[model samples]
Target chain A: MLATMLYGPGDIRCEEVSEAKILHPTDAIIKLSASCICGSDLWPYRGANEVTAPMAMGHEYCGIVVEVGSAVKTVKPGQFVVGSFCLSDNTCPHCRFGFQSSCEQREFMTGAQAPYARVPLADGSLVATAELPSDDLIPSLLAVSDVLGTGWYAADAAGVTEGSTAVVVGDGAVGLMGVLAAKQMGAARIIAMSRHKSRQDLALEFGATDIVSERGEAGIARVKELTNGVGAESVLECVGMEESMSQAINCARPGGKIGFVGVPHGVTFDGQQLFFQQKSLLGGPAPVRRYLPYLMDLVLDREINPGKVFDLELPLADVAEGYRAMDERRAIKTLLRF
Target chain B: MLATMLYGPGDIRCEEVSEAKILHPTDAIIKLSASCICGSDLWPYRGANEVTAPMAMGHEYCGIVVEVGSAVKTVKPGQFVVGSFCLSDNTCPHCRFGFQSSCEQREFMTGAQAPYARVPLADGSLVATAELPSDDLIPSLLAVSDVLGTGWYAADAAGVTEGSTAVVVGDGAVGLMGVLAAKQMGAARIIAMSRHKSRQDLALEFGATDIVSERGEAGIARVKELTNGVGAESVLECVGMEESMSQAINCARPGGKIGFVGVPHGVTFDGQQLFFQQKSLLGGPAPVRRYLPYLMDLVLDREINPGKVFDLELPLADVAEGYRAMDERRAIKTLLRF
Candidate 1:
């Protein structure tokens, strides 16, 4: 099997590696239908996050189960399934509360960029489809595993409701999906903040009612202007940087909600400032497993086309090029084929 | 008229001051039935908050309308009313959204410890009862103006619901009110974190199901033990210091909410730490104006006895002693009479 690994800054490699195998009774082996490079992958590649050792590359995945340990009960051989980036025993208290990302037995998925990957806690982490889906739905199903589920969580956390206004602070793939989720949630106004033409076009396609190209104070001003100076009721902070977080906070009216999904690096908040701002904030790794079932149904039913976010696709062997395309802003996302 | 003033830290005095007068068309002059010292007033008295000038000492009050400006329409002479410490134009979008503290023309009420005080935005900030209530309800009605309203806001912001568990972080008058509010909201269990026996008794009287005397990690652990190792669904952070805030956050489960009403002083949050903690955060000055009418009715009906929080009663001439008692923790709160 060929798997993607990162040796150091800007050094992503695809080389022959041992096949993924079940190491625990709760584990299952799945042959990936598709995989992708997440924006977070750029952290270590850019030297922002430490690359202490050769790190396994992908977390987003969807595939068919080829083998299962005896203890795995829900998913079995020949079944199609999608799982979250954050693995968890869904029966835990946190999981039952719909915060699977913080489940007591939580673990993060890894090495999914390869043709085969081992999924732990298979019965609890994987949601199997009733029947095999058409080949055309693979990309969309893969998306429900993380990207689409995350965006949906962001919208849900923001408290977007019918006839309410929403502001998305990033124009990444997740941000575009956030626009779609807000639209589905019946938000009357969806504003996407982006400077790039391609991303803006995609945002509009995903139901963004307005686009603000400005970045800092100007961006906030434009959003306020669009909202008639009262700011949006819900704000989705898809980028975790300090500036983006500040923008997200400022773009909401008092008593509004901010759902941040980005992994923060060096962000810090003054308690007095946040108190005066008076906005509701809830951010963390999206409990993708909680939304997996409903989102997969949406994908399978063809009600949404989240796969449109994959503007670039490549073979597993060209994994490094895929990372480069997204790192260099040449692609919104890169879908890798086995 | 004699009014309380803080010349500097530990320099509180009761001195003759000019009579209150309407300075704006929206103002109303009220003859206070009673006024009280607030825990927040201790902020500047203890030098935690800067005191650069002689500051009027109180913000909690309820009284009969003595006079009204020409433009004042809702309130008039002879009507008994309760006004929030935060004055707001209720017609603004923020106020309409139920966040009166963030109203566009927001102002903080001052000189409230005096026998007569002018209230700005009278029509919007003051909620008048149909008839004058009996003297027995005066203290409770005064509590609604700030302390009770603030505690209720904390519970509301934390999303206290039927059968939910709640943890209150402070044991001051406001936190005591939070216990009452959580009880009214039907929380299955209410935990008051306090080490004082007197405060604990009041907490139990106000519907606290549990009292955790430990501070810091031990306190959080006790709360967890009581909740079956699953933290409370809602936490009311009534103490604005960093330690209390941290304790409040740690005392909640993932996806739990922390509604903080205490004015934060010199507190900061590491973005990444908060992100991984995975709890919802919403804090600010309580929008007491939004809860004023309902809370006032509860007080008038005697369904609740919030006035019990006022453990000390003093003549207005002894305002300095009242401050000293509260500052030294000798009294939970002080009621001042004209």
Candidate 2:
């Protein structure tokens, strides 16, 4: 089977790899329908993260259960399903509490940017729809595996609700989707901070009430101005840089909540300032599995077209080019069809 | 009137100062019945926080209303009241949402160690009991102004529940009171980490289920051992330092919450680690005014005796000695009788 492999920074290749099999009783073999690159993937691609061996790439995916292990009961062969980036047994205390990302018995469902992948803890990690989704809807379902789910968690953590003024502090695919999540959660005002025309348009289409082109302090000032000098009630930080984190904190009203789903890069907490502001920071690796079922419903119902984030598409063989397009900021997001 | 003043770090003096009067229309003058030094007061006294001018000492007290300005309606002369260290109008959206510490109309109450001090936002900052309690209960009532209220906020923010296990980092008055607050909040097990005999005894008396004398990594190891290697469900960080903050984060279970109320001296946030842990950090300057009423009721009902933290006492004229006692670690807390 052909799989995407990361050899080092700026070194991505699609090569024939050993076939995947159901090694564990709780595992299942999945034939990929669609997968995409994540913003987090950029870290390793940019050489920001240490990459030792050429590891299988991609964790976001939706596929058909080609084969199921003996212990896999809930997910059967021939069913269409979406699995979380982080696979979990779901029965563990952490998973039961909706923290699947931190489940004691968990595995990373990687190598999805390929023809086939092995999904562990299939019975608890994979969620199936009543019927297989059309090929056109595959991208959206694939999103549920990671980006969409993470965006949803960001909104949830920020306590976004009806009449909530939400400020999304990033313009990446996840940030645009966060605008959608905040809108679906009943946010009255959604501010998307973006300087890029493509993402700005997507954000507007996804329900951003305003846009702030400014980046750090100026961006915060613009948000405060839009919020009557009080700042937004809820802030979703999708960029994991120090500047972005500070913008999120500075753009929230005193006592407001900042739900940051971005993989924080270089940020430090200034205790005195955070304390005096009375703000709360709640987020980490998103419990994507916990929101997959509901998000899949939203996709199935066509309530939202999140798959539009995939502005560029390519065949699985051109997966390396897809990574290049995103790395160069030429495409908002790239969807690889297998 | 005599008031305590800090000329500089390690230099405290109690001397005659002008009597406080209603400076603003919303101000009320209070004749202090009892006051105490807070753990935060030691920050400046220990030279951790610089004191430039001859700053007035103390921010916690319970007093009798001596005079009220024309705008002060809810509180009148001769009413015994408990005012928060942070005097807030409690009418802004932030205060309305129960974050009085960040109230838009906030004016910090200063010189609480003085015989008389001016209290701002009298209507919202001061909460009077049904009537003045007996003299014996004065110390406990004084605590409601800061330390007790802060501890309660810590427990509340950490989401301590009836069956939850709590770990308190720091052995100061607020940390010890956090043990009491966690117990009051129905925590099943309270682990108070302290090496001080006086504080450990107080913690045990306050319903600590275990005592871990180790600090940092060793302390976190002990906490994990106590909780079957899962860490505590709730952690209260009452010491604002890098090591203490890290210990609090390490001691919390995945998906757990850390409530920090200590004035953070120097702490930075490691975004990547925090993200993977799924831990929530909630706290800032506590909204003491929001908790004073309930805390006063608890004290009135004799359900808690927070005043036990104060091990040293002196007349208002000897306020300097009180500072020295706490700074020298000879006293857990100091009380100034007026």
Candidate 3:
């Protein structure tokens, strides 16, 4: 099997790796159909997050199951499936309560940008479609594994609903998906903070009502202006930087809700502002598994086209180029076909 | 009129101040029936919070309407009323959405430890009871004005429901009231964290299932131990200190909710832990006005006794003593009777 491996910052390689086998009775082997680079993956590639030794990369994928352990009952071989970044048991107290990301037996998926991979907790993690999706729809279905599901989680956590005025921070793939999620959920207005022309177009296509190119205080001022000097009812903080976090908080109305799904970096919040300003903040690794069914349906039914985020696509052997394209901002996301 | 005024840190005096009168068409002059010192007041009294010059004290009280501006129609002379620390125009979007403390036209209440108070936004801030209550109920009714109301907001914000395991971080008057609020809301197990025997007794009396005297890490560990290593379902952070805030977040089970009503001081959260831990945190000033009506019914029907928090009572002339008692820890709360 060939998989993408991260040796160090700026060093990505696609080479032959050990064959995938059933690690446990609950594990299943997946023949990767499509996998993509994520903004979060950039953290380790840029050396911001510590990466010791070479490790398998890619935590997002949609694939067909080639083999399954005896213990895997729900998901079976020969099924097209999508799974969350977090492999959950789905029966733990946390999973039962709808927080699969924090499942008691949760495991992070890696080495997914490969020809084959082992998926543990198959019964709980993998969701099978009625049939294999068309090749054109594979990219969108693949996004449901992480980015799209994360965006949906952000909107759900922010309490975005019909008539809700939503503010989306960051113009990355996840941020664009957040716009789509808010739109699908019936948000009356979605103000996307985007500066890039390409992302701005995608944001608008994803259903952004307005776009604010400004950053920092000016960005917040623009959102406030759009919200009648109050601010958005629900704010999605899709970027994890401190500046992005602060902007999201400031962009919400007093007593408004903020849903943050970014993998925070150097982010710290003033407790006084959160308490006195009455901006409710909720964030973390998204519970994407909980929303997979709903989002998969949306993707399969063509209600949403998240695959547009994959502006660059390459063969699995060119995985190194995929990382570079995203790292250099040459692509919003790069999908690797196996 | 005589009022409690703060000249600086550790300097308080009962002195004659400007007379209270209806200052605006929406204002009502109330003859204060009862007033109390709050934990927040101690911040300024102890020099923790700056007090630049002599300022009127006492932001919590229940009083009798003595006069009203022509615009004040709902509240008239002779009616007893309770008001939150924040005077809101209940008609604002935030207030209409049930967040009166964050009302756009909100004003902080001050100078209530005097013989009279000028209640602004009278129609929205003042909740008139059916009639004058008996002497014994006066203290409890006064609690409804702030402490009890604040505690109730904490529980409500934390999403407490039947069978919830509630952990209160503070053991002060508000924390005790939170225990009572949890009880009234049908929480299955209420855990009050306190080191003081007096407060522990009050907590047990208020329906606490267990008392964890440990503070900080030990306190969080104790809570986890009691909840089958899962932590509590709902955590009420009644104290605004960093240690208490962190404890509350750590004490909540994964995906659990935290309602913090404490005025945060020098508290900053580690964004990474909050992001990956999947804990939902929301805090700010309590929207006490929204709960006033429902709570008033509970107090009037003798369903709750929040006034038990008043451990010391002094005449209005001995206002300085009232502040001293709470400052010296000789009382959990001090009531200044006018």
Chain A superposition TM-score per model: 0.99, 0.98, 0.98
- Model 2: residue B215 alpha-carbon error in angstroms: 2.6
Docking class of 2: medium
Point out the worst 10-residue segment of candidate 2 chain B by lDDT.
B268-277
Candidate 1 Cα errors over 4 Å, as ranges: none
Largest TM-score belongs to which candidate? Answer: 1
Task: Give the DockQ-based CAPRI class for model 3.
Answer: medium
Error of 1 at B79 (Å): 0.3
Best by lDDT: 1
Tens digits of lDDT, candidate 2, B1-338: 88888888788888888989878899888889988888888888888998878888878878899999898889888889998888898888778778899888877777888888888899999998888799989989998898989998999889899989999999989999899999999999999999999889999999899999999788999999999878888999999998999999999988888999998887877778788878888888789988888889999999899988888988888877887787777888988887
Candidate 1 residue-wise lDDT, B241-297, digit = tens? 999999999999999999999989978998888888999999998999999888888
- Candidate 3 structure, TM-score to reference: 0.96
> Which residue pairs come into collision in candidate 1?
none
Better of 2 and 3 by DockQ: 3
Better of 1 and 2 by TM-score: 1
Tens-digit lDDT track of model 3 for A21-133: 99899999999888888999999999999999898998898899999998989987899999999999999888988899999898999889888899989999999999888
Backbone clash pairs in model 3 (N, Cα, C under 3 Å; residues 3+ apart or in different chains), count = 1
Question: Which has the higher lDDT value, candidate number 1 or candidate number 3?
Answer: 1
Q: Share of real interface contacts recovered by each model?
A: 0.84, 0.77, 0.84
Candidate 1 lDDT (Cα, 0 to 1) = 0.93
User: Clashes in model 2: which pairs?
Assistant: A268-B269, A269-B268, A269-B269, A275-B284, A284-B275
Error of 3 at B162 (Å): 2.7
